[model samples]
Target: MNINDLFLCPICRNIPLSERESFLNGLNYHLKTYKKGAFIARQEDPVEALYLLLSGSVKTEMISDAGTVLNIEIIKAPKPLAPAFLFAENNRFPVDVIALEACEVVFLPKKSVMLQLSSNEAFLRGYMAFNSNRTNFLSERIKLLSIKTIKGKLAQYILSRARGNYFTFEINQTQLAEYFGIARPSLARSLSEMLEDKIITFKKNEGEILNMNALKELVVS
Candidate 1:
């Protein structure tokens, strides 16, 4: 992997090349690899470093007291891991980050990250923007979890992404089921019901809203 590419990750984007190189010069960092199914960091682990994924993907999941696993999100390479938690009062991993596949990551001690935040204006701006977006994402997740039915969750999701009466799905049903904490069959059944009710019409990877009012009602109800 190109070392310079590390400077292009989400938290480092828009930073001037010279300044990025300067900050990286003599920087203390560690590179680590994880195999598929490996737990990179378990819940409650200290947030001692800024983890920048260099390759592959991972899923952030939380296990409930009843041993149920709630999949929070899937993060691919070229992104920071739980950046918003880095400086929180409870500076610890809130979810278990497990490798979805073989992966490599760069670990920069929080002290070094703080130094970068202080010295690099662009870096600071990028960091803040990333965290702000993360906050919004979490808020949406909470809203999704609050909905009582799978149909309601599906309606909210589709309506959020729909452009006018048309929309495209980014992930397949299987992945989406995991993200929604439901079984594949259940999601498929809900979707079939929606189609049968004429609330939506579907094609491969895309759909058209046949009854916008119905979708909105499902979400609100």
Candidate 2:
């Protein structure tokens, strides 16, 4: 699909890129399709381009020296993550990005992005705001990972999804395991415990939400 037709700037879903011609035209950009499970870029690789996901999902991960793969974050459709080159000090990617499904991405060269940002105040503001939000998200994820118990982590995750009085979304066991950085069996045990405690509910093929007040109590107490 043409970048213009996509309309939604995958990085900032609420903003349409068609309105940002100065930013779009200044960059040497190309649209590329990636197959499911394709590696978009590896950890420590030079940051040459900023990618905007046009379709599908991607996961960011890092492998430790002990060969343990730590799943850093998952990028859903219509959002972008880890545009490392926008920062002067981030010359290389700190984690690997892999397509979770067949996807299309628009790649904008780093040099062009820097040039455009230098001359366009509006684009600069938008880019800065994006990075600021990213910083806050990373901070929260770090805090979540620091929680020692599986139940505590699960409680935090559910609390994050709770909006007003409702909480529901699609997620599978494998995805949950990846997000929690634990084995599937361990996640299963934790999930079962939560269900038994009446902290949350779920069904096969359907995702889950929480007993919000119960979840909050678990999180605090």
Candidate 3:
């Protein structure tokens, strides 16, 4: 994608021409590419620049006290993350971002972005709305992780994927365990239980949804 097309304001997916010009004028930002598995940013890194994913995928993660990497979220192409932190009082990144595939990104200096936001009402409003949505998403994720039982967590996860559809996204057992912050064996046992209960079924390398209603009941029970 052209860098212009990729220029999504973190607060709003689209950037108005006036706002875009103002941003470009303030920050001498440029697009750069990173290979898969490359570290885009490290935790607690100085909030130097804001990042916008132009192409490919990225994952945000944090290291726990025990030094285990806890995956936070997977970001797809054309999405923006982490710019919100620049405007926050902390001005520090809470998690690390890694490229999951060959990725292209746009980076703008924090000072430049803030300058533009201060003078631009439109950009400021978009920025605030974006942060609000991000906060809500994080709140829901916290709720998901609060479930006591592995089976309950898995059920809720599967139901979330199904959402009114019969197809669920394919994810390997290892990835599932990592995403849920559970041990491999515990995740395996939970999956077996879910399969036995007819809540879900799986193909060799794909996901299948058996009963969404039953999965919801399992999550709540």
Best by lDDT: 1
Error of 2 at 29 (Å): 2.5
lDDT of each: 0.89, 0.73, 0.76
User: Which candidate has the highest TM-score of all?
Assistant: 1
Residue pairs of candidate 2 with colliding backbone atoms: none
Deviation in Å, model 2, residue 212 alpha carbon: 6.8
lDDT of 2: 0.73
Q: Please tell me which model should have the higher lDDT, number 1 or number 3.
A: 1
Better structure of 1 and 2 per lDDT: 1
Model 3 Cα lDDT, one tens digit per residue, 1-221 = 47675555455445577566655677677888999999988898877777878888999998987999877878887777686777668877889999999999888777767786787776678777878888886776677789877888887776666645455646787877876778999988878877887778865644677777777777778
Q: TM-score each candidate.
A: 0.90, 0.73, 0.69
**Of 2 and 3, the candidate ranking higher by lDDT:** 3
Misplaced by over 4 Å in model 3 are 8-12, 16-23, 31-39, 56-61, 65-76, 99-103, 118-122, 158-174, 199-217
Residues 1-221 of candidate 2 have per-residue lDDT tens digits of: 76763346534343444546655667788989999999988888877777788888999899998989887778876655576454648678778899999988887787877786777666666677778887887787777788877778878877787666445645777977776777889988987888887767766733455476777666655
Off by over 4 Å in 2: 12-19, 33-38, 56-59, 71-78, 99-103, 118-122, 200-217
Each prediction's total of clashing residue pairs, residues at least 3 apart in sequence or on different chains, is: 0, 0, 0
Clash number for candidate 2: 0
10 residues in a row with least lDDT, candidate 3: 5-14
Backbone clash total, candidate 1: 0
Score residue 47 of candidate 1 by CA lDDT: 93
Q: Which ten contiguous residues of candidate 2 have the minimum total lDDT?
A: 10-19
What is the Cα-based lDDT of residue 153 in candidate 1?
96
